[model samples]
Target: MSGGIGRRALITGAVAGAGTLLSGCDRLGRDERFQRLLRTGEGGNYAVLRLLQDRTALAQEFRPDQRSPVFRMNGVRMPNGDDYARHLATGFADWRIPVEGLVAHPQAYSMAQLRAMPSRTQITRHDCVEGWSAIGKWTDVPLRLLLDRAGVSPQARFVVFHCADPQSNGTMYYESIDRIDAAHPQTILAWALNDELLPPGNGAPLRLRVERQLGYKQAKYVQRIELVSSLAGINGGKGGYWEDVAGYEWYAGL
Candidate 1:
């Protein structure tokens, strides 16, 4: 499975798996107007969820024995490109997660550098909106630690993950979280899963894991982290690839 599965195939599998629950929502995938309406509804839910939830609420964590026997790979399985191929071949020895945009000191961290920093490990469940769930252990550096080291600017309002994988529409895959989520204790840039160096199917090298949100919010194959005041100008301005294409909610809070 090193080559990984195609993005369309993964979506189809998810759609099929959740068909029973999505009986009336099928067309939302292709209807732009409906998607916008759907987003509006999701926005309201988000507002209410945020209002009622604690600022630093933590997602439930599990014990090692509770981890799922098999964790399905989500989102883009393999990023397409010679450069990515080279990194994969070299075991990401030369790969870097560049931190830039609205930061006082922009910095890029190689795998070694990122691994050298203090890391946190947690066994947690990943609930996908597609009506499935899996529990796995994730280990990585807290995003705030990196942001502090980078000296994130006071004006920055959101952290955007620029990934190596692109959607079928050729739009580069990305996801964003507000400053509040960025500084959450469970929010990390994970480089390992299940106590092992993350496999390609599970976002090797690095990935964003904002534990409080649903699986879609966890952007994988991350290449860069961009700090910005707003997501209004990125892609379709929906804050994420699925949000722009599949009408998936941007704020997929549990």
Candidate 2:
């Protein structure tokens, strides 16, 4: 769960507005070639970058004062359902993140338990595939520590994130990352943004912040974390909701 790109190859912080995210689908959707480029070219680029870059290199971090004036909430604003509403009404007190799959000990962590764990806060920029980006502060427990507590099995090659948000077909939205990104120092399951409890529009209960990748990789409304050996059986099996339907690359390395 560790990997890196070169120090010079890293992006400092290029912030784009939320609008780019909304139009990303149509822009890429209409152009078959553009989508193909990402699929064939970008995917290989990620592998090459991984080999050339330092596995432990970290994304640039900023000060609180440098936070974005407005951090746009992307993806399902609020997943539709009575269960989700009830949890929201109760301020996610009963919500829990179930860690299962290829773990030695399956466990469900309540919000309180997550907050009680050691946490890291960082101000970093988010880059969306569509063309927009923003900088913001996020606070959450290091995902690596959680994986350690769960005792990830040697057979687990990828980490799957089951989210509360639903995709177009009604299946719950989900995403995944290789062991490298999952163990990166900056990758976290952020429960708070901008120094406050995460808002519903921004994945209130929990969201992932895998800073080195594009925004789509930052899954929101995370309900479960499952370590697995393969992504072949999950929903369209491309590794994410957008990737399954919209052809986004699984490793959106930037």
lDDT of 1: 0.88
Worst 10 residues of 2 by lDDT: 9-18
Q: What is the lDDT of residue 172 in candidate 1?
A: 78
Cα lDDT of model 1 by residue, 226-246, tens digit: 999889989888799898887
RMSD of each: 12.1, 12.8
Local distance difference test, each candidate: 0.88, 0.89
Candidate 2, residue 210: CA error in Å? 0.4
Tens digits of per-residue lDDT, candidate 2, 59-169, equal 999988887899987878888999999999999999989999999999999999999999999999999998998999999999999999999999999999999987778
Error of 2 at 77 (Å): 1.3
TM-scores of the candidates are: 0.84, 0.84
